[model samples]
Target: MARLVAVTAVLGLLLAGCVDPHTWPEDQDDIVNGPLEVRTHWQAFTLEQPLQINDEGRQRLHLVLDGEQYESNDLHDPKDYVNQFNPRRVDGVLIEPDIILVGDNGNEVRVHGTGSLGVRTGRLILAFGTHHGDFEDFLSRPPAIPDDIEHFEALRIRSNEPFTIEALHWSVDRHPDLHRCGRRCTWLERWLMGE
Candidate 1:
């Protein structure tokens, strides 16, 4: 059964990204012109379904932390130098509400950002670029994520789909999974997956 299942997963070709996938679905009405500026975001998501981000969702930065409502100032304050998760800027769209993606293969990833869930082609990808710091900084020392802010425990994205927060990176160490080049996976996610 195990071998059969593994073969099935491979046959599925569980590719998680697309090239030039429309930022918004063709059916979705155009809301902005010439590349909508999605600024002040930190994390991002690969979505499966549609959801809403109302005024409150937007104001709250679209994150639910510690089961409590979390909000983002989107102020991009200098004081937030220690917190990479703080309000930052990225160019993307929120096709839906935030939810983590857990593949059938036990690979998982999460994206935290200004606010949004994503979708494109047949797959959904909501991406907000993270400030991994300059090339030198990344190789030497990735920017700090503030000791005060809780990691895995703090992020709680309500979702109906099966999910996995326990595995920090995707795929078990025994086997390697696909690397999502586009919005499907962020640099941080890829790094974590390797670890």
Candidate 2:
């Protein structure tokens, strides 16, 4: 259908924006209110719980995610992480830089977290899909906590080339010391990740 074709064309354009976390932006606010395609990459949190970030009344890009929860609607056990998050409202504002977290090479106040985020450029596209988890199954393997088994600092503004500290699906849930054990992990990751 022509409608489907138009949608595909629009999506192709937005995705081509190179909305990676490392893509530095001159104005961070632009990202705070860009298209869902771009904005969704900026921040993600549930209304039941939000990261209240502040710093001496100054403004900075608040890259924050609540500490892992042991039990909740999204999670029933400590072993359970966010199974599949949906960012109904992805938004943020440019605030003051984090003083405690700074880079050794410089002092730009490095910030990182496992959340959705994107560079604020020019765009207008919204894609709906799973926002988190799909890897909590690893917790059942023992010694595989959410923190260690997962890492996704979408926007750190790091001095290094690899500004973001994101881990691939495989790296996050390393294969157990067994045969074909990674099958479920791989399938789950791909499914929830829209792959």
Candidate 3:
């Protein structure tokens, strides 16, 4: 009898992780319809667009973190940077991201971006970009930089699909005297672009 009871308890614990729950936290429901259904469908998109600086004197540059298409030269000429997410496709639209992650934040931050791609039943779309500030700052107050560079992760979601990392990049020129985050940042960009 004692052996049977122990076996049953162990079996129950094993089954818990495999069970797919239909519900999610209320805050997460908006982007993803539900927990189990949304996180599994999550995927990463990569763009071929190169990084270019803007002429507004802001010293800003645009990066393709994840998406379907690439921006054209005409757009780059004027420093428009409007098609940040490559918005030409009819199926999946590239969206501007609202949420960004930087470094290890003690806890993982959730996605809170404002735009959406017309993702269907089994797909989730993610867009990527970069800026010259602590990626964590977007979520809360920026953190003190111990090193010149850091890598950040972003997540995107849709109904019942798995939570997916939409984009990953390092902020190279975040500090005043610092120029670039060095080879690690460059390597991350190359890896993301599948170069």
Candidate 4:
């Protein structure tokens, strides 16, 4: 009976168009819908402090970027840096906000920035471009973010230039039983399916 059941399960998976015998149905589906940016060079930094939960149950923190501290072609000052997160959502799933621009001048400090939660690692990448007058187009776009990271805490902008601000993320282990079929299973399925 055990061997017969195993054969039937393999046949069912094959009929569902499972190309690789090891590829589960859930592997073919992407539940998180968001535009992810890939990056190669970024410096890792430890979280300055542990995450604090707010009354709303959302986590929060602050990342500060001081551009003036870095050597740059232009005179880096704190007021020159500015950024924005364009927020959007689909079917109640919150999409990752876009970091429109990060500049050294003609921009205001944003109270919040983009980030990902449950990430084990975090990074900082520098964007290209020099400072141009507000009338001219010279502000640099936000650096690319890794696909797996999500969650943004607060942003604290001061008089600085050429600095990257990033939030901490926690990496979580994938749940073994939470798949397409849902959470709970019958005793027979649990016993025979090994999940």
Candidate 5:
């Protein structure tokens, strides 16, 4: 009975630590390596559509998801947009600001870009643009993408403000449209076809 009680107590404490009490627009405490919550507002693909395997070769698709974070405190205006932080070069020293992405599985991907980045003091708008590569082995195992859907619910970005690009269950699929040339095209295809 004592052992059972101790185990239960430990489990309870561990679970408590996992809970994040800070809510968006209210919590902006950490500016550097701090947790910022980002909600997915929109997403797009670099290629017009999912790359189809042609000539028995491998295919890859580039995905982009845009997210945003808000600061609704006296320190920041609730209605203002928090831009991403930008690094500067001082005295020939190159300072690079970085943001990290944390997936639902605890895997992390680093975000690198200067788009929508802001200064730490005067700016609050942080724009999150994340890219992922999806590779398909045409010869061995072709991607069985159902109706051309891409699932990215397990992806999130970590920065001064935590950004959730999409919900853990988010999925995106491409549907054929008449005007889109009966199939989506990418720069690769354009180059290959010499168009």
Candidate 6:
């Protein structure tokens, strides 16, 4: 009886260790690097400065989602005519930016533009829980752009579970000397001119 009890206690301890929180798989890195599809739409409000022009002599903004590429000629550009419109301002704050994604049971997610920059931008991804109410909880809040985010190409969403990015809305501080020529103009110019 004594020997059997000792064996049972050892088994219990091992089982408890196996269930330890530290033993749980860390999902952060996987979520950040996992395969994802993100679709974003944006509307611009305050253009405090002149529009930055590309090598083609057209204004351009590099828009990216889950490795997909897009460009905008103007801040007011939209995916479709019906969906595209100028941003509306409330109390001097622009409130027209939104994003939606199609995923797992057509789950729709929306993001509001918080802020942005020439290097990186910030947004708030708001998740609405589903019928089960299991997934309705808020995911990770948006973090300030890290120093490594040098450009839009480096932007990524870090999450644990499977997540679909629905939309992004934000304004950029105007690129400087947009009227200038050569590689110095805008990020688009640098790519186009291969400078």
Summarize candidate 5's per-residue lDDT along 129-156 as a digit string, tens digits.
3322221221232333333223212232
Q: Roughly what TM-score does model 3 have, to 2 decimal places?
A: 0.24
Runs with alpha carbons beyond 4 Å of true place in candidate 1: 1-71, 76-99, 114-195
| Collision count for each candidate, in order | 16, 9, 17, 19, 18, 5
Q: Give TM per candidate.
A: 0.22, 0.16, 0.24, 0.17, 0.23, 0.18
What is the lDDT for 159 in model 4?
A: 23
Could you tell me how far off, in angstroms, the CA of residue 86 lies in candidate 6 after the best superposition?
Answer: 11
lDDT of each: 0.28, 0.25, 0.29, 0.26, 0.28, 0.28
Q: After superposition, how far is residue 46 of candidate 5 from its true place, in Å?
A: 28
Ten residues in sequence with the least summed lDDT for candidate 1:
166-175
Query: For residue 157, what is the lDDT in candidate 6?
Result: 30
For 14-49, candidate 3 gives per-residue lDDT tens digits of 434433323211111122222222233444322133
Tens digits of per-residue lDDT, candidate 2, 146-195, equal 22212222332212111111111111111221212233335533343344
- Name the runs in model 5 displaced over 4 angstroms: 1-95, 117-195
- Candidate 2 runs further than 4 Å off: 1-31, 36-106, 112-195
Cα RMSD for predicted model 2: 20.0
Candidate with the greatest lDDT versus the true structure:
3
Candidate ranking (TM-score, best to worst) = 3, 5, 1, 6, 4, 2
Supply the TM-score for candidate 2. 0.16
Residue 61's lDDT in candidate 6? 26
Candidate 6, TM-score vs. the true structure? 0.18
RMSD of 4: 20.2
After superposition, the stretches of candidate 3 with alpha carbons farther than 4 Å from their true spots are 1-68, 72-94, 102-167, 174-195
* Candidate that beats the other on TM-score, 1 or 6, i.e. the better one: 1
